[model samples]
Target: MSAPRRPVLAGNWKMNHGPSDTARFFADFLNRLAPADDRSVVFFPPAISFAAAREALQGRPDVRLGVQNVHWEASGAFTGELSVAMAKDAGAELVLVGHSERRHVFGETSDETAKKVRAVLDGGLVPVLCVGETLDERNAGRAEAVVAEQLAPVLSIIRPDEVAELVVAYEPVWAIGTGVTATPGDAASMHHAVRERLAQAFGREAADAVPVLYGGSVKPDNAAELMSQPGVDGVLVGGASLDPGGFAAICGAAG
Candidate 1:
């Protein structure tokens, strides 16, 4: 028999929630759901609320806390930047790098993202690396090339054995928050391609073991179909995750 796939459901609470709001959400969320022992569930909040999230999740073995972004430095005078050490101090077990918004809005280059990945891993935090293609690139038949390019620099920094410690989310730029989800077939195709690239870069065993999640408009209703795909390991939920019950349902589907 095949081993059961480990499911990861991460909530990217991008730019939402203050300290008080963070506390309230966790209070309600923890109270409502059973502990997620069979799967891994993460909450990725903005840099400002990392402490609040840490405080709330302390001693709670059920959930893992994550950070939306982290600078590729141990410590520095870089103004308004949160370093990997700072994120670790705040209790983040995972750090998100190369998110679509970070790439499109903040202009984070792949080289910088690679540095951040190394920083996070060196600091003992897992990195959730985001890679995908823009609508323009997809229309121009460059979707695969675009994603491959994004993965190239990061692959150079980490070994195949290290890939399992990192999570990759394939979120199409056009689908994020636009309420348009990629068909399961489309998502599976890209996920398979990503696995192929990993195999070429790191070899077969490492490629098959790495978990690649599908993000962009993922909700309870569509989660099962996406999960049914061979290469899809889990989901990176956005708006649906704001509600504890809704997110719980998505996790249950993964289960």
Candidate 2:
């Protein structure tokens, strides 16, 4: 059998943390974090702070740095947007695609996500594809369908072996930044559905190799339980991750 997939604890700093703050955050975080080979820990800082994060993570190659977003094109007339090559130049090893805020707040579409996924892959960067439903969709019992729709296009563009370079993060819009978290069972159920969808697209073996993460209001206190659920390979942290100590504790829970 192939080796078990490693748990990934990813922190999405979002719009917070400037370069100096990024440096300070990692200084404290790395101090608190004990080196372990059992899991992976990644930080998705803002594009501007990539340098500081990379410098802070100099000796620790196991802790990776990622870009919050990347444009599909290698170069463009588009201003204020960084392309995949630019992101790679900025030292990002992973790119977040289709985050809920990118969709709801900025109107990013699934097709756009698919393109970005392809670009990141071609650029030799991993894509942490975020998929989930809003509160209303979940209430209507259309959560799984919505997630499927989000994944279908991207799945079509990726080969089965490429699944190894992909990570799926389920971040319910209602739960994100609302202080409301889905119960472990709820997250696991959605993760299972996501894995099933991947199985259909890439076969069961490839699907099982993908690391499906549960996000949205995940905290140090509940992180262990969330990661314990079946199909929950890890977590995508937001506000709770802004705190160095708290994020370290959350990473510890991934074990």
Candidate 3:
């Protein structure tokens, strides 16, 4: 039988924390995060703070680092954007693709996101592809449809063999950073839908092995319950992750 899916606790700093703050955050985070062999933990700090986060993560190789975003092109006048190679050089082992802000705030299209996913994979980095629906979409009963649409382009490009390294995060736009969260039941249902979509793209065995995380206002109080739900392989934390102690508490809960 295939091995069980490993839990992944990832933090998306999202324009918050600089080099100094990153160093201090890791200093405290590492202390509170107990060593574990059953799960994986990753941090996607702002690009500017990559070095500081890397330096701080010296002894803990188990804790991986990632870029919040990447450009599809290897090099160009895409001014103000970092290429996949640059991100890899910056010590990123993974890359976040199609984050809510990038989709809504920055007008990123699924086609573009597809290219970024391909780029990240080609550059030998893992891609944490974030897919979710907006508040209106959910209210209109189109949440699952919206998420499937977003996943289509990216999923079509991923080979069955790559499913194990691909991390899909379901972060409903309405709940993110809005002090709102989906109930465990609601989150689990969505996660189940995501897995079904994965199964359609890759086979059941490969899909079941993919880590599907929930990431809408996830906090310490509700983390364990969310992680305990079937099909919720892990979480992608936002605001709550900014706090060293709080994030550590959430990580501990994942175990």
Candidate 4:
């Protein structure tokens, strides 16, 4: 039998929570769920709440801390940007790159995403690299193509040994924040394709070791089904993640 991929149920609390909110969420979540011992339930709070998160989540080794975004540069005059060094200093152990919001809203290109991925890995932090297809592309039967294109640059930059540390979130653009979810079968198919691509690039052993998560409108109602699908290692939750109880419930499904 192959080694199991530890499920990662990540809460991407984007621009929604303050420091107080972060503290409150954990306090409630820890009370509701005892946290699965075998999975990674990461909290990707906005940068402003990292300090509060670190404080609130202390002593809970079962919970991992992450940040929504990070700059590739270590330190410079990149105004309004938080570098990996800054994130590390602020107690972030994982960082997200290529999130759809960073791609579409902030105009972060694949090359820039690649830079961030490399920085995070080199800095000893894990990188959750998001990749996906737009509605039009999926309708055109270019879903796989789009995912490949988006991931190509980052894969090219990362070393083979670092492959296992990467988490690829297959988020369909149309489904994100739109209350629509890619059916479990559909998400599994995409995840299979992603694994095939990784195998081609880094060989099967390394590929199988990497966790490919499904994102985009994942909720408690559907989290179990999605995570149960073959090749779907976990979930990268958005809106539903804001609710501590809801997110904890999703984490429960992952195990």
Candidate 3 residue pairs that clash: none
Task: For residues 1-255, write the lDDT of model 3, one tens digit per residue.
Answer: 134888899999999999999999998889888677788899999989999999999989889999999999999889889999999888899999999999999999999999999999999999999999998999999999999999999998988777887889999999999989998998999999999998888878898888899999999999999999998988999999999989989988975
Q: Which ranges in model 2 have alpha carbons more than 4 Å from their true place?
A: 1-3
Q: Residue 77 in model 2: shift from native, Å? A: 0.7
Worst 10 residues of 3 by lDDT: 1-10
Off by over 4 Å in 3: none
lDDT per residue (tens digit) for residues 123-181 in model 1: 88899999999999999999999999999999999965577787889999999999999
In what order do the candidates fall by lDDT, top score first? 2, 3, 4, 1
lDDT against the true structure, each candidate: 0.87, 0.92, 0.92, 0.90
Clashing pairs in 2: none
- Candidate 4 residue 114 C-alpha distance from true site, Å: 0.6
Q: How far off is residue 167 in model 4, in Å?
A: 0.9
TM-score of 2: 0.98
Count clashes in each candidate, considering only residues at least 3 apart in sequence or on different chains: 0, 0, 0, 0
Error of 3 at 203 (Å): 1.1
- Candidate 4 regions with alpha-carbon error over 4 angstroms: 1-3
